[model samples]
Structures are given as C-alpha cells and as structure tokens.
Target chain A: MIAKELFKGTIKTIVLKLLSDQGKMYGYEICQKVKELSDGELMLTEGALYPMLHKMESEGLLKIEKVNIGKRVRKYYKLTRTGKKEFGLKIEEFNNFIQTMKLILNPSINQSI
Target chain B: MGLSDEQVDYIENLLKENGLSYPPLLEDLLDHVCCAVESKMDDGTAFQVAIKEVLNAFGKDGIEKLQVQTLHLLNQKKQLMKRLSLLTLSVLLFTVTYIFAFPIDPPNSSPLKGNAKITAEFGMTFNKLKAQNQFHEGIDFKVPLGTPVYATGNGVVTEIQSKSTGYGHMIVIKHDDHFESLYAHLSEILIQEGEEIKAGQLIAKVGNSGASLSPHLHYEVKKQGKKINPRDYLTP
Candidate 1:
C-alpha cells in the first residue's frame, strides 16, 4: 500500500479531474468513485474530502447544487468554466512532471544519457 | 435498507451536539454520514453499529473537527489575511512607540560582521506559493554558507538545539534579565549551552537548515518572552 503522504498533493488534481469527467458528484460519491478506481486501494476520508470541496467551491472552481432526500440535504459539486480550464493546466503540468520522473527513474530505456 | 427520517434526525442532532454550526458543512456531513450508515445497514449491520463505525471512520473529534477544518481552509488566505494585516499594523504602531520611549543601548551589536543583504523582512506578508499570510517573527539575512554568526548582546547561552526541521540548529541566549535573542538555521554551533557570551562573540555559522531553502540566519529578539522586531536593536 502506498503511503497517504504521497497522495496529499494529488488530491486536488484527482478531484478536479473527477468533477470534469463525472459532471456532478456528492461527497460520498466522490469517495466511492476513488475507491472503485483504485480497486479499494485508496479511500478518501470524509475529513479530507469535505474541506477540500468547500475550499474549491469558495475558490470559484466548483459550484454546488443542493438536493433534498427525505429530511437530509445532499450537496453535489460540479466544475465551473474556470475549473475546466484549471484541470487542463494541471493535467499538462502533472504529465510533464511524470515524464521527468520517468526519465530519472528509468534512464536505461533512453538512448541519450 | 434505508435510514428512516427519525434515524436521520438522530444523526443531525448528534452533529449539532458535537458543535457543527456551519450550514454548508453541516449539510454535506449529514448526507455523507447518513449514506455510509445506510449502506452498512443494507449489508445486515445494525443501525447502532453502522453509525458508530461511520463516526469512527471520521477519526477523533469527528463532526466537530470537520467544520473547523473546512472553515480554516476557506478562511486562511482571505479573511485571516485581512485580520492579520490589521493586527500587524497595530503591532507596528506599538513597536514604534516603544522604540521612541526607550532606545536600545550598548548591549546591542550587529549579528553579522558587515552589511548583509536582507532576503525577508519582519512583518505580516503574503506568501503566494504557500497561499497564506504569515507573521515573520524574525529578520532573515541572506548570507553565504559558513558565514560567521555573532551574539548581539552580552548574555549566557541558555539553549542549543539541533533538529531536522523548523529552526534547525538554533541557539537561544538570555540577556539582561528581560531580553532574549535567538539565532536559527545554522550549519555549526560553536558555543556550548550555559557558556557566558560577549557581545559580537562568535556563536555559530549560517547555513541552509530546517525549513529554510537557502543559507541565511533567522535572528529574533524577544522582550519578556514576546518576540519583538530585531530591526529595532541591530546596528548598521
């Protein structure tokens, strides 16, 4: 199992990508989706996920819709236009970082030293 | 296998009892906890056991901590910055008054040999990379590695500490009963704890240590256990 510290920086990127792909997701749904995607290897705790969602909402990257189920209210988060643009920027940056790491970790594959 | 309205009310009441007062956070947590409990009930678990397991998964302080953490993340860069800037302004006013009332005297000496470049100032400033506003307690001098560090006052070395992070390799000196000076992020500590130190005496050497990214000395002065601006005391 991977250490949770390694996942800290990637949490925001993962949330942005998820919202971009899934359109709208509630807190629990995001957790379940992450778990499913990771094949139960990752769990996004409620403590970590809710604060980040609220922070993103305040940052104008995400908008919320409140739906009532019985007596309880569920908040669904969807990406804004800025959020979509941000996802593109972040994904590009992450891909570049991955490529750099790959070159360092596996230099034997490349012809150039 | 869904929770009844009464069961939902019980959970909501529990959240409120734990001091969760924010509306948006309250709503999100309420729904999330209910969903978790309902899913467990569907798998043949009792409602009591299910709710306990759900709250346990939230870790210690549970619902109460969620609201505090959410508010902190939202408030940090915006509202907190505004409040901190106001506080800094008031503190600056007090420091100016204190300086005018009684000037710092002969015990004061420059911590460095000659004119050194200051990389960061002592005051409230916003760090864009960290996305936070911080009150820098000390003045940071941008110097080369292994640069000699001096004691600013006649004092006894009271503490010498070495750590991997945060004020790593630091020394604290007690001066004139009410005043204390600190030097942090050192590559070498040349003085021993409890050793008597004279003004301008060599005590350490600057280096990139602790949470620092570059070689520099973080020097601070405190009066009666409160950190005051060292800029008020240092000579040119």
Candidate 2:
C-alpha cells in the first residue's frame, strides 16, 4: 500500500485520468474503482477523495451531474475541457517522472559515478 | 444491498448533526456512507453493525474536519468580500455623521443683515419696567420692526414657538449634539420646524411681539443644553 503523503500529490492526476476513461463517476464509484484497479493496494478515504473532487470542481476542472435514486442524490464528476487538456499533460509528466525515478533507483555502475 | 429511505435519512441526519451541513458536501458524503454501509451489509453484517463500521472508518471528527477544511478553502475570498463591505459601511456612517453633527465650518456670522446695536447683554441687568434685577439669558439686538433675522450657522430648525409672552415667536436651531442657537421676538417666521437652515440665511423678521418695550431680536446660544454667551460665536 502507498503512503497517504505520496498518494496525495497524485490524486488529481489519477482522478483526471479515471474520469477521462470512465466518462463520469460518483464519489463511491471512484473510490471502489481505484481499490479494484490497484488490487487493494490503494485506498481512497472519504476525507481525501471528496475534498479533492470539490477543489477540482471549484477550479473548473470537473463538472457535476446530480441524479436522484429513490430518496438519495448521487453526484457524478466528469472532466471539463480544461481537465481533458490537463490529463494529457499530467500523464506525460508522470511517465517521465517514473522513468527518472527508476533510473535513480536502479542505476548502472557507469552512470553511478 | 441498497439502503431503505429511513436508513438513508438516518445517515443524512447523522452527517448534518456532525456539522457537515453544506448541501453539496452533505449529498456526496451521504451517498458515500450509504454505499459503504450497503457494501458492509452485503457481506452479511447486520444493518446496525454495518452503519457503525462505516462511521468508525471515517475516524474521529473526520466528517466535521472535512467540512472545516472545505470551507477554509472556499471562504478565503468570501471572507475578504464580507470584510470589505463592513469597512465601506463604517466609512459611510462616519462621513454622514461628520457632515451632519460637526459641520466643516462653525457658526460664525452674525444673525443680523445690517448695522446692529447691542441694547442688552447676557447676564443680570435691571429691568426698569419691572423695577427689579433680572437674569437675562440672551443678548438683545435693538433692530426696527420688519428687520431680517438670519440663522447664525448651518443646522436643522428644531423648534418654532409663537407666544404673546416671554421669548415669543422663537425659533431653535440645533447645530450638533454640543451646540444649539435660539432666535426670539419675531413678527413672522420664514422657515418651518425641522427645515435645514444655512448660515446667514434669512429665517425670520424682527418684531416687538413678546413682553418687550421695543422691536429687537433676542438671540441665545446653548452649549449642551446650558446657556452660554452668544457673543463668543457671533462675529461683530
């Protein structure tokens, strides 16, 4: 399992990517999907997930669709135009960061000097 | 496993009581808690046990802390707007009070329009008709009948009295909380009570209407309701 501190910075990128793939998802669906995709190695708490989702909404990165199911209302979030553009940039940056981290962690002897 | 309406209501009320009353945040938290409880119930846990487990998962004051954190971020701009509005209102109130209560210019001009002669001064003097010493409260200006009487300062006309006795046909103008001026022995009043008066504005005509031997204007100045000498404020 990843520590919460490490997971914090990646939440927006992950959410942007998730919404891009799934189109739209509510709070619980996002949490359940992350846990399922990570094979129980990642957990999204209500405290962490909702604030990030709301912050992104306020920043115009996501739009909400509210639906009534029986007596309860469910809020689903989808990426905005800006959010879609951000997703592509974030994915490339994250990929480059992962490659850089791998090089440092598994350094060749010639490069280590 | 889905929650019943009553169960959903219970979760909502719980979140509201714990101080998560913001509607959007409330709705999101409600849906999440219901899903958590329903998932737990699907695993064979009883309804009561499922609800407890879901709440405990949020940790202590976790629901409340979420709202506080959200509002802290959202209210940053709103708080500034509120403070600016309060400051604007205070400055407006101060400006209004300063203009009305303390005029930029003090009462300086004499209440007479032409050559003025002092027949009586403020303080004790002998009244030959009554043949006794009388404490005169105002300075008496000996002006002919139909002479114009003006307001000494910018103020509101607080009172107008018409009588055939002492200080007859008087007009009182309150300049501020600290100062008020009075004009008496007038034949005709040109302004109404509560009317705004300006300095040197002709407000009345001098007459011998009260208990007097000749036509004169009786003027008095009071500081905080106590009679003070009018000569201090009236320019010669």
> lDDT of each prediction vs. the true structure?
0.88, 0.89
Q: Calculate DockQ per candidate and list them.
A: 0.54, 0.42
iRMS per model, in Å, is 1.1, 1.2
Q: After superposition, which runs of candidate 1 have C-alpha atoms over 4 Å from their true positions?
A: A110-113, B80-236
Task: Report the C-alpha lDDT of model 1 over B70-155, residue by residue, as the tens digit.
Answer: 98998885786689899999999999998877555334688987899987788986654366999889889999999999999888
Query: Looking at the true structure's interface, with contacts defined as alpha carbon pairs within 8 Å between chains A and B, what fraction does model 1 recover?
Result: 0.86
Cα RMSD for candidate 1?
22.3
User: Model 2's CAPRI class?
Assistant: acceptable
As a whole number from 0 to 100, the lDDT of residue B168 in candidate 2 is: 85
Write model 2 residue lDDT over A2-84, tens digit each, in one string: 99898988998989989999999999999999999999989988888888888888777899999997789999999999999
Range of the 10 consecutive residues with the lowest summed lDDT in candidate 2 chain B: B100-109
- Models 1 onward score TM values of 0.54, 0.53
Cα lDDT of model 2 overall? 0.89
TM-score of model number 2, chain B: 0.56
Q: Candidate 2, residue A10: CA error in Å?
A: 0.5
TM-score of chain A of each: 0.92, 0.92
